[model samples]
Target chain A: MDSSSLLSRVRVVLCRPSHPGNIGAAARAMKTMGLSRLVLVAPRRFPDAEAAARASGAVDVLERAVVVETLAEALAGTVVSVAFTTRSRTYVQPFRTPEESAREVLQALQAAPDTQAALVFGNETNGLANEEVWQCAFPATIPANPEYSSLNLAAAVQVACYVLARTCEAFSPQAGAIADAPDFVPVSHEAVEGLIAQWLAVLERLDFYDPAAPKRLEARLRRLLARTRLERAELDILRGMLKAVARKIP
Target chain B: MDSSSLLSRVRVVLCRPSHPGNIGAAARAMKTMGLSRLVLVAPRRFPDAEAAARASGAVDVLERAVVVETLAEALAGTVVSVAFTTRSRTYVQPFRTPEESAREVLQALQAAPDTQAALVFGNETNGLANEEVWQCAFPATIPANPEYSSLNLAAAVQVACYVLARTCEAFSPQAGAIADAPDFVPVSHEAVEGLIAQWLAVLERLDFYDPAAPKRLEARLRRLLARTRLERAELDILRGMLKAVARKIP
Candidate 1:
């Protein structure tokens, strides 16, 4: 699916949110990843100062967020519903990384452009209840250290968006310039190694290596050479030098 | 390279942001991925109520965050620095996904674990200044849609840490577990260089260099050994064999 449809058609659902600040922070997170649609399920507080203030520059996202009374209401129109959970459930459900889920979401959207997908986040403390988890199609988990895997609400939103953004191939601090010039690539590693080998031959032939009482000089020299990051043209010029010196010697 | 040292040896720096809440959110994002070191460079407003409120339960992250006057100060002592950008500059640069950059960072750390690496983010609006991007070694760009790619500051941090965490081998949603397991680490570049020098002496004594018409054989040999990624113990064993062989030379 095209980027516009995938981004515009996806919805972020926060179920029974307890905090005004988390709602605001989550709004900011959603906007950063190019997500516009936000659905809140029975939030304790709506349009609160803390939520708006927490959104920072993304106040528009808070203003645009859709408020609903239940998780079912939020999931009503979405073609797919993905829930973020910490615990391993009794009944096994297939869990996919955000990247994989994003692909699936996009593919589903591609097949049905009018339909949408929902990324659901549970309440701060109770998390998504068994009934809430049962409503979602995919159970997703962020791979964090299990000992202290209690990820904050908005941070989870940020990671989910990040993975989605990466999977969908979205934004940059500045990306267009890099995208326009793909041919200007670095010298291949193989070429760099070859040039270094040539230089080594010349140095050794010039009697640079001292067999007896050899100090750390050669290693230091190698390090110095590595620093220059010799390009392809530079490598050719140095290779020419090697040929010249080789002919000059016996 | 182990996951423990890599996370500890990396710093996340946000430079000259206009919002205090973004800084707070960015801090919380870092902690979720097991990253703690945060350095702020000349933010417009800090020690702010909005930032603390946005940080949620991660107030400790804000409490421990380092505020600095310049990006250089934040970058001081870091062995490598990477900058995130959206647009490409006049001269082309090497851009890699956060996953790839993390591996390179880990490899560098394995060579010198005591040293640190820095990932720098630009201000909220201007993104990173061209001069700021120049200060970094790798110019990283997250692929987002060009039409409206303005990502939230903390979301970018989340994506970066998420990619890094995946490469270092998954969760301590708490850390310190991997920090204790430092055995079987990569040998330092200096150590590798020293080993090459010792072997060169051995090869010369063995008449492998052909004293009259020595070619680029030594350089080729060095390049080949460099590819092996000699571990510390491997270097020691090779050095011991070199010494033993050198003693047998007539």
Candidate 2:
């Protein structure tokens, strides 16, 4: 399952969110992580300017969001749902980290392509009640400060979406490879040997290399050259510098 | 070093942030992850009511935040800093994912307890300039959607802090263990055997078990019993149910 498809199977469900700005912020957060589905359950306000302003570029997510009257309706087709909560419950529910929950969700999506998963978040003030949490098969929590673990609703969504994106392999740092350096071709072994020979010749011309007392200099130079996974452009620069130095040696 | 102290040594630096609400949201994000120190580099507006309101319970982080005129000034004491950027730069800087960057930062903090590290975020509009990014030792980019990768300023901060908190083991889902279940004692071997015996006795009284045609039922029951790592309370419930059934069988 590719990352985006895996993420597509997952949805973010906000239950009884009071602040319209948080709804917008949550939309922006979800979109940034490549998650487009948003389900708002009984929100206090919708179609508000504050949410649109906060959503910034992700107002499309809000525009396409599904507003439901009940949490069950929001999670209608999900094969598995994770309740995002911090409150300690009386029931014996196993809680997993966001990373763990994401992995599980992705695994389920991969195992059964048609299955959907949901990440459910509660209101800003009071989190999901016990009855609401019971609807979810998995309960996940973010570890925060003991003194103050009050994570803003949108901030919590951002964290969960980030984890899901990372776990699904949707985005990676290597994805940001230098786009401008299109000509960064790796030099061959023979090319590296040629560059080393030229460097030694330059050093000999400059009186920097001595036949009488080489003193492991050639071997050390070879090790250094091998250590660097030189690109063709870099090899060219080094060879050019050596030629320039040799020409000026006289 | 402990997770809190390790997190305390790291600070968040927002360079040229334009929105006061973002500053407050960033502060809230940091506090939720057990981070306290915040440094702002030439924000467009500060000491604004919008920032305070957005900060929510994290106003203390904002109040104690250090405001500096220059990015260099903000990063004075940091041994290493990660420039968070999504821009395609002309320079050959390596971009790491947030998780990898967090591991690197935590490794540095653990190696030298007194040394400090910083996660630097760019402006809401243009992000960090190339010159500003060159000032940092490492550059990080969040793996976001290629089509719509504009993560909100505070949302980015939340993701970074959440990763850092997870890397430092500051908060974990296991920390939300059921606090009310104080008497969750593991059942003794003798108690489990006793319960099994009682259950079999009840089944025999009800004629569900036959001496001549056991049909591997006893072994199957034993296997089922071993599969469950029963608690004392669970064993008690089972034993009580078996006793009631046995009394009714007569």
List model 1 lDDT by residue over A103-208, tens digit each.
8887787788689999999999888998998999888888764434667788788788878876766654334444423323346768766765665565455555
Q: Write the per-residue lDDT of candidate 1 for residues B55-102, one digit (tens) a residue.
A: 766788788889999876787666566788775444244566677677
What is the lDDT, from 0 to 100, of the residue B102 in candidate 1?
Answer: 75
Query: Which pairs clash in model 2?
Result: none
How do the predictions measure up, each by TM-score?
0.67, 0.75
The per-candidate TM-score of the B chain, in the order shown, comes to 0.67, 0.80
Interface RMSD per candidate (angstroms): 10.2, 29.6
Q: Candidate 2 — number of clashing residue pairs?
A: 0
Q: Which structure among the candidates has the greatest DockQ?
A: 1
lDDT of 2 by residue, B200-240 (tens): 66565555567678776676556545644566655665565
Cα lDDT for residue B131, model 1? 58
Quote the lDDT for A50 in model 2.
93
